[model samples]
Target: MMWREKEQVLMFTFTFVIYAVCTIILFNIMYRTQPTPYMDEIFHIPQTQSYCKGNFTKWDPKITTPPGLYLSTVGVLVPLAQWLGWEVCEVYFLRLTNVFFVFGNFYLLYCLLLNLHPQISESKLLLSCLNLSIFPLTYFFVFLYYTDVGNLFFFLLMYTFHLQGQDLVAALFGVMAVFFRQTSIIWVFFVSMAAESSVYITMKRTKLEKKSSSLQFLKKFISTTAALPVHHKKQFVNVLIDILDTCGGYLLTAVGFIVFLYRNKGFALGDKDAHVLCFNVSQVCYFLGFVLVFCSPFLLSPGKVKKFISFCIKEWVLTAAVTAVMILVLEYLVQIHPYLLADNRHLTFYVWQRFLGRNSLLSCAFIPVYIFSGWTVLQTLQHKDSVWQLLYILCLVLSVVPQKLLEFRYFIIPYVLFRLNIQVNSYIQLFLEFSIYVFVNAFTLVLFLNKPFYWEGQSEIQRIMW
Candidate 1:
């Protein structure tokens, strides 16, 4: 009956309600369209059916997805069909494996949250919703009947192992993830190597016994440069500008050095010169990686720097960028293109119908989502959570593929969860984010349903589900 006790009870109820609402919404979306067989479902069902029927070659040998998924898929399908006196290709039964795997991933994510934050707060609830509401993850994998669900399961398990200090087990899982889809491993691995090196550098440096403030660093740098002899002042400024420009090419663009210096002033790590150095190094690595991923095309050239940038662009670069632009542009153009004098409709139809297609667009949108998912990878790196850092980095490295890559579901799951955890500090910011999320997801859901069915009537299995 005490006021404090009442407050505690109220908080508990509020958190529980938000969590329940998110969970229900996720499951409802996942299951409502369950009966619709996506194009990939045709491939998955046939492979699973063949495996259950003991026709090993029924699955594609060229399909080098992880062996664990194959074994588990078979295990789930074979025994259940016989016990229930249903065919392996049975529609409801066929999608069971995917549904189970999807839910299993959610449970794994919950466990991860529990481990990372033993005592949950409202932020935890918000983070949980942000993570679980990942439109791309569920949108791409759950309905498509792809190996992403299983791949994601293993990827999360890998993180769990690392968090639990089981490095060897995590490495094994990391390897399996690569086998599922090579690109997933590549993303995680790059982060791991980069973070490990950072920690090592941090360990070697002496810790600061007394830290100075950011204002102090700025004051000292400004006063020192200002007081320098007239000749040295310009030289010092030029040197500073050169350092920034040579480093990331970011200094030459937009607000450049001023903006960077201002941002780094806060991230300056007080008076610990060593910590400051290490932090700068880590920031450079992350910023470079980010720039390389997002804005590489702007910097492309034949030189060593540009070559490296081009290499980082990867084959999916065009697909990913174009897809994001197309989504934002398509609605506007769909009505006007047909009326254009040049028969722009023909051009649009050719591009959408024959070339890019719906499935390809899904894959393309999935790439940006997966890349954004790496926002968590950056946060984990900053926190220097060694276990997570290691697993995530390794996964990033091993999962990379050069072209037409679509099956990195494992990395996608952690990427989303990690991103959600990297929220800014404010109620207003959170509300704005939630509003944008609602609008985008609503639009995406509509887009997903309205697209022509690609798998229907493809085969007997397709009829039941697609």
Candidate 2:
């Protein structure tokens, strides 16, 4: 057993090392020229400089993200650069901090995959590791001097803990990730329910397996139905007990009941459960925190029943929900605490416009990337017959809508979640795997080419005969 554990660790470490090296090389190629980092990067450097100069007051507002990365930036890199007689203004060193975090992100992803798919064989594990290395958009964000790098790491870390049945740890990590980028908080809503649902599925399967040998149990229900006598033979009480044996199973059973019945569409037993009151309470807490931003008021106010009806019946309910939340949050913040908008702004369309307009070529390139990405996630969720897939779809819609309303940066975390969703078939699996490799390498090559990376001669290409 000890030897087996060591072997697993060795494999994980080996995979991590290879992936990290390849990622760093790709990033080095991409950011070689211009080297102009984002404004947020510049903002952080000044904060760190203030801290190093024994001035901590101005640093407080900039500490929206956790102190872990900031401390390292100030204590290690800033000091080293100063000692080497180098100017602190060099953006390369600040970007270098993200280089290291990218590996840490990979490690977290590996650990999360392991936790979620522990039953997978060694060969599949290696394949999954390679999958991480070749993930298409990972290169773009992983090497940037942006909070997304750190947020992605902690996001996966919390997800890993959730997969391991550590909900509290997952919640904490998720909260931290959202603090770095508040829009990511919506993911916490979906993931928590999904994790709970997954847990329930596992437990139900286990109980069914444990009871498989019992034949007499079917005799009682034989009179009620023919083909599924065994299914009908069981009482709701007995099934409920089996579900109650584990928290996850109970939620799943409830979700099944709520989702399957047309009258209860979008409702799950888990949603109705008193125990889930705690989760709702957590949402309320998040709403309150962002209250100055507008979300809290809408949730608190018993808005007109017509709006709720519209939200429910809308074809794009997920999109509508996100927009409504954005309006609610933004309006409240503007009204009550306009001062917050003076310095640290919240939920503006400015970010989205900048991403698409400023990064037009790369944004266009990302279209195929996201298409393949959405295709993969949809295929995966469609593989299962359970109502949970509907919830997953809603979540996907919610993820995309924010990018439409606010900024393209909002799409980053959602896109990551979509990609991380498993593939339902070999076709999707192979396509994603191949696309990640080809796109990353191609993007790198494009950046390295002497000419501009923009399209030059699409109409001039000749088709080769098969």
Candidate 3:
């Protein structure tokens, strides 16, 4: 174990050297061509500058999320920048904060996989961690002033701590994550329940022992107890106590969120009008399809495709059920928020115009794609306990189902969470994933840098981004 841990360090260092070289190259491009705040960086950079300058009272109304990003920037990186003789308030320097966040995220993801998949080889874990770090949706913002990477840092930190059985520390970071984005509160409770489920599912295998999750696990354990006669009613009590212990801190975090809701009257601190809640179940389909495409390199390989086909044929009923449900979701629940229609500078706008939203038939044609994507993604998690799988589906629904907009950044955490848990067949699969990320990211950055266009009535040139 010690030698493998050392090997992991070596792997992390090797991966870091590659990622760091790429980040520096991207940073130079941004510095030379797009040094000023672009897009949402306009809001994020200025607000963080305010916090850095010790103006705590100033806030950006256009910023819907809380001040966690600003607080973290000012609290840690800002001072570090000063000590390093860097300009703490420059847009370029502020963007540098997330550059460092990239490093931190890489290490945190390494620790997370360490705790979650100790049986895996050091090299495989490194690839999974590095692949997620460079995932196109999240990686594009690494050289920009964005909260997505920073918030994800906290999210990964929270889950890593939870996996290590440091539940209270995990819960604290969960609150910090909520402070970064209101939607992150969903994952906060998700980590809580997932941790609880881990304890219950792994309980036998300690005794081996939620509403949906808790109640379902209880029913199974009760039935299994009746048959096995090892974990009795008394042992069940012990399992329940352990579950409560695991989830208690996150429950407090939820209470704090409730109190904020009661006092503030809603989830968003500002710009509630734009961030209004909606039941756009279509977003979930789009996300699943996005995940499928990214994972297609491995998942669409000949052997995997054959397996998928076999499963579909043998379990035709299940395949039909998934297809039918997707049909309903696409037909009635598809939504197109105004931003998607208006923002030509975003990749989603073109995606909507060209593929999914070009016509009703074109959109509905994606139902099969959604089903295949969803099935293959679920197949990756097949080795997990039934409760873990169930809770994962439930959490993805809660996280993805309510978005009123069609932003791919919202897909980042869910994709990372899903990708990290899946099995990899070979080094070739990991290489394929890395190859895809390189192609997409290289194309994206080249487009953004060389293909600048001016928006009507706006002075600064605009570049498309994910």
Candidate 4:
């Protein structure tokens, strides 16, 4: 067993070395192909460069997120660039900051997976870490000056620390994550619930059964907490301490966030008009479909499909009711944002035009797909803590349901969180997932590099991305 562990470590070393070299090569070609900052970089690069030059007062009104990305560049990456003699604030070098973040995020994910699944196979954890680091939505930002990579790093970091019982440190990182993206405050609350609910459930393990009524369950839960002496009283106390520490820290940060919201007048830092919350019911459905496709290795199987078919037959009435509700929601409440229609440069445009929005019937046809994906998503969480699953569903709905835009990039964090929680014991399935991810990455990267086209009136060469 000891030798097997060593072999796994050595294998990871080899795989990581190859992966790093290839990543550098691909990033090199990307930089060479488009020396100028493209798309969002047009806003991000200049703003960051200003901060690098000690011009902290400079602000980009069109940029919606906070100054966390730029501040990190000034505070950390610039000093590292000096040590390595790389040009400080050079566009290519500035973008290379994300490469550093990519490696760090991979290591954090490996640690997180091990923490979450200590008894799971080490080889499986390593593969999950590597594959998630290259997940296309997050991966595309690795070679560009974008906030997504850094935001993800801190997010995984925050959750890792929380799960490892470092509540104070977890809260610190959670605050940093909020700086990266305001929506992360929602996740801070999520981990807090997961922490407190975990202890409560652990204290009441055998006594609280699912058969009880909601009133009975409530009484049992309250009584269980009141009767902590039934278990290790000291253990329960320690957990309470941790929970309180986390909540206290988060509340301080939450206050700051509320103040920002009040002062800024809304969530979006700069572009308020474009980021309004709307009743986009199909948004969550679209996200679930993304999970089904991207998570095919874990979710798609003949056995599961056959079982779902049988279950559907048994639960036909339930399924029909769900489908009917979804169809009505899609028909009446699906709001087509002007950007999705006006922007032909985005992949969402074609997807909306040719597939989902082709006609009324075709759009409603996807209701069943949405239902199946939702089922698979819940199945992935079935083994997790019951409270955590409820929290997960609530947090996911809050994160994606109100988004007025159809950008898949918005779903990256939830996807990563979902992907990390699933158990994959089969080598065949893991490798198949890795293979498919590689294929998609290769295709998308090649398409972006080789298929530059001129937008109708814009002079900058346009390349498609998630």
**Local distance difference test values of all predictions, in order:** 0.45, 0.48, 0.80, 0.82
Ranking by TM-score: 4, 3, 2, 1
For residues 265-344, could you state the per-residue lDDT of candidate 4 as single tens digits? 99998877998878787888898888888899888888877878887899999998988888887888888888998887
Q: What shift in Å separates residue 180 of candidate 1 from its native position after superposition?
A: 3.0
| Clash count (model 4, backbone only) | 0
Q: TM-scores across all candidates?
A: 0.49, 0.52, 0.89, 0.90
Give candidate 4's error at residue 276 in angstroms. Answer: 1.1
Error of 1 at 8 (Å): 12
Better of 2 and 4 by lDDT: 4
Clashes of each: 27, 8, 9, 0
Q: Report the Cα lDDT for candidate 2.
A: 0.48
Q: What lDDT score is found at residue 244 in candidate 1?
A: 42
Off by over 4 Å in 4: 1-5, 81-86, 196-243
Displacement of residue 107 (Cα, Å) in model 4 is: 0.9
Q: Over the stretch 257-291, how does candidate 3's per-residue lDDT look in tens digits?
A: 99999987876788888877788888888988898
Candidate 4 TM-score to native:
0.90
Q: For candidate 4, give the lDDT of residue 74.
A: 81
**Per-residue lDDT value at 280 in model 1:** 14
- Candidate 1: C-alpha lDDT: 0.45
Worst lDDT window (10 residues) for model 4? Answer: 197-206
Which residue pairs of candidate 2 clash? 200-248, 200-249, 254-269, 293-329, 294-328, 294-329, 295-329, 352-407
Better of 3 and 4 by lDDT: 4
